[model samples]
Target: LHCGTGKVSYVGGNSKSPALFISLLKRLKATYRRAKTITLIVDNYIIHKSRETERWLKENPKFRVIYQPVYSPRVNHVERLWQALHDTITRNHQCRS
Candidate 1:
């Protein structure tokens, strides 16, 4: 997740899910284990707020996860980056679904 100053980026071989995200959070926790809190502003993705994800959050009191409004892409800076990436790499690409 991207913050005002710091960021935690990961590339995974598997698909995105609550388990992978929770693992990333565990890494963030280890990085700043002593920190009082780590607030993550995330998009309105299903996995982001799944029951498993909520359970993970409950177990780790130091982390707070907030979801952005549905359909409000303007608030998410990464959306712009993703759009650019699509324009650059996937605009005319064709692959198996």
Candidate 2:
């Protein structure tokens, strides 16, 4: 999300692997291709720290990733936004599918 404009960039539909993560990062980079750099705050998942992920980061000098504590939900700034999203979208809903 852009702190100044509240612009959020989101994407999905890839497997939980470093290669897919790199693809997602590329998509995000496309969103701000002109910007000098992009800093992403993410949780410490195993796939994030893999050799493949490291290689991708090495190749992408303009992108940076910050990892928070493994078990601390509060450390992630977007947690509140996510909770609100669930409450507003799925609360009191009946799903038959």
TM-score list, all predictions: 0.73, 0.76
Could you say which candidate leads in TM-score?
2
lDDT of each: 0.77, 0.79
Stretches off by above 4 angstroms in model 1 are 1-8, 84-97
Least lDDT summed over 10 consecutive residues: which range in candidate 1?
Answer: 5-14
What's the CA error at residue 22 for candidate 1, in Å? 1.1
lDDT of 2 by residue, 1-97 (tens): 7777888776554358877777778888898899898998878888778898888889999988888875566678787777787799868986554
Highest-lDDT candidate: 2
- How badly does each model clash, as a count of residue pairs? 0, 0
Report the lDDT tens digits of candidate 1 across residue range 1-97: 4565546466453578888887888888888788899888777788788899889889999997778875566787767766887899779996454
RMSD of each: 3.4, 3.1
